[model samples]
Target: MPAGVLFMFIIVFTTLVAVRMNSYVISALIIYVFFSIIGAVDDIAKVINQRKIAKGLISKQDYQYKADGISAGLRLFLYMTISLLVAMAAYKYIPNINGDINLPFISIVKRFPSLPFWLFIPFMTFTIAIFANGVNFTDGFDTLATVPSICCFVFVGIISFISSNSIWSNYLLIPHIVGLQEILPLIGAVIGTLLAYLWFNSPPSTIIMGDSGSVGLGGLIGILFIFTKAGFYLPLVGFIFFMEFASVAIQIGYFKLTGKRVFLMAPIHHHFQIMMRKSGLYKGEFQIKSKIAWRFHILSVVCLVLGLALFLKIR
Candidate 1:
């Protein structure tokens, strides 16, 4: 079973209880589960295909396509459509949530600059979709995606908690988003769940979170930043995921533009793993994987600190 489905349910229960059934928390959980279900469907497809392969029902050539769960075109279509609907619903139904966003260094006297619905919907949708896939890419390594994600939620939780307080928001000069505090419990639930996941996902992993977990959690984080009015800071906080997604994009775009490739393998982590393999520096597969995972974890920690500093201290 994809632990994501169970975790999502747990998150929903814990957050609702923590917030005493806050409407915004309910709305957020619904969106989180929506994306998770999409990923779960893909995960189910892959699982069934694996069973078929084991039974010698799928040929090697056909296995590649079958193992990938849903077709890329179909997956992208769903991401775009669902993201658009979520963005529109967020804008129209969610209280105090709007297209307004926070800038890193800019200070607004009375109001933050806002985007019209026409622009905001597309922008938010893209953010959610890109991040949903970005995290899926990052999950290629054991505990690679889990630790950094925990770090990200830690930063987001702190920021959201502070932003919900008028005194702290004014003191730090961050936007005071009403009802944003309700998300703190949700973040807490997510962080707690990820921590537990990390215990199983550590180097020499027992199981993986898979697409079901990654996509749902990724989509949730994307929207969390938006609700906190810190969408601009996402790249700063989740730079590891951004790089993973970018590496693939760069590899594909560059390969088509020229005959050369950027990384040995796309997603960057795999590239690093390949580089380690070629150098013959790492003694074993376990060491190489652990080394790369640790480096990414450390980098994520650094990013979390810098992102928070810039968000809270540097004007």
Candidate 2:
């Protein structure tokens, strides 16, 4: 249902934006395709995959189902981390990559001459991945990942709007943007739909977003900023993603490197989920499962606010 609402919102946002922008038929069609189809395809695929498992068609369910409830947070985390590293490296050693959409959108601007892009990649990858995972990490339970994603996108998309127009860009002290404004409304609508989806997806989630949703969200975020081309700033925005992945990363690292397990389970959320019963965190706790999820909403909101302030100040 949460996924369905996102689909519907994408449709509405696409149609209105297309008409308002007077986009060419092809462009408008593409917009519809991206928002309506590309955005939702991952979720659909997950459903298909899960159905296969349910029907005993596929048996590889070990790690596949591990991140089910926490996928949205995880995907955005990793995609941004990897993407940021690539972008920074490209911006550094390679020749200038500036243009309309061709430019490395998110990484170090060639003109900035600040940090060497190459030098930034490792730090960027780890940091961005950590932060991105943080959002997921905070996603302890229902409505956590989806609700915050919706809010963050709305805020991030608005930044694009400020950049889209020269006047507003100047007023906001942001760069002038083109064609990106279209993405803002599209994202807004997508997230708006996601917001609606959260109504049904919150505590005791009826439908887990799974990795399909998380990774896709991260990918879309990369595309939106032209960051995918260069892989920049992922660490800054995707704080929550990195943290979640880090838990697993750390767990794996320790086990492999030191031969010890950190948490009884990885991702941290599952640890809490498991311990909740033993620790009495969920016993008659008005849906103990739900109480866990509410924690995510609060944490993501905190990360969102902090990330927004930093991004704007840095840019």
Candidate 3:
């Protein structure tokens, strides 16, 4: 599981930080482990169940629970194991973080109390659940999931532009964080991985990012952004996610209050899919101009661009 690999990274990193006497990384490591195990168990159980179902002891409906989930679990398990071994090697690549690497940004971090770092754990956890659940709930058509995610990641990756450069951090008056450059590679890895995922997730998607990748990616963005001092604008950067989730939240709240449906269903994407399927919009002269998946990708990119502009402008 990618969660496991990420946990491995956090653990090794925290141990080194602990060995070096910085406790924040240790705190983060604890949170990372907790999150990773939760996801890993879910993944492991799904994979085991899928195998049983494939053996014909269980019904095919079991396999249909999350078609891509089992494969994702297997990928996550292998990747985590490999990452632990590789993370061990990175220690040799980067012996230790020094004053030079930690400079310019270190002072800015000192401005904040240590409590925020600890509190950041809950923030990250909730954000992941919301982000992942929103993505999963929104997955009704092609490009809807992956493309929006790509925009979100790219918007998040731009944080490095502010965090990586001391001059920019100073000019922007944002908290400077040394060693945040480490997140750049993480973002690159995600983008590259998504590119591979997109090959199958485009048009008629053969695979979905499922909850694993969605939650994983969302958590990665939130944590890296805050660690890099760009946490302030995450909501705006992920505006579409918030809007999509809000629709469902509003629907549920309304139904509880009035016992009436809102938007015809939860997560407006599915409502659009229903309309398209019923109207034969896929094959008719009145075929929808902006299909559900296409609109998701476009709107996500548009908002990401706007968010980036806001970031560059305000910062």
Best-performing candidate as measured by TM-score? 1
lDDT of 1 by residue, 119-210 (tens): 88888888888888889899987888888888879988998889889998998888887787888888999999988988887766777887
| TM-score per model over all chains | 0.94, 0.62, 0.64
- C-alpha lDDT values of all predictions: 0.84, 0.51, 0.54
Specify the highest-lDDT model's number. 1
lDDT of 2 by residue, 21-133 (tens): 52322232332333233335545666667777788887666437632433655544544545564545544533322322212223223343333444545434443334333
Model 1, C-alpha of 250: deviation from truth (Å): 1.7
Minimum summed lDDT over a 10-residue window in model 1 is located at 20-29
lDDT by residue for model 3 (1-315), tens: 233344345435544543433322333333334434445555666677778887887787866775554464564444344334322332223322111122223344445423232354444445545654465555445556667777876875676656667898777655455655555544555566667767876654566544444544444454444454445566666666666778888998899999997886778776665677777638742245246666667778788877766656542
After aligning candidate 2 to the native by TM-score, how far in Å is the CA of 26 from where it should be? 11
Backbone clashes in model 1, listed as residue pairs = none
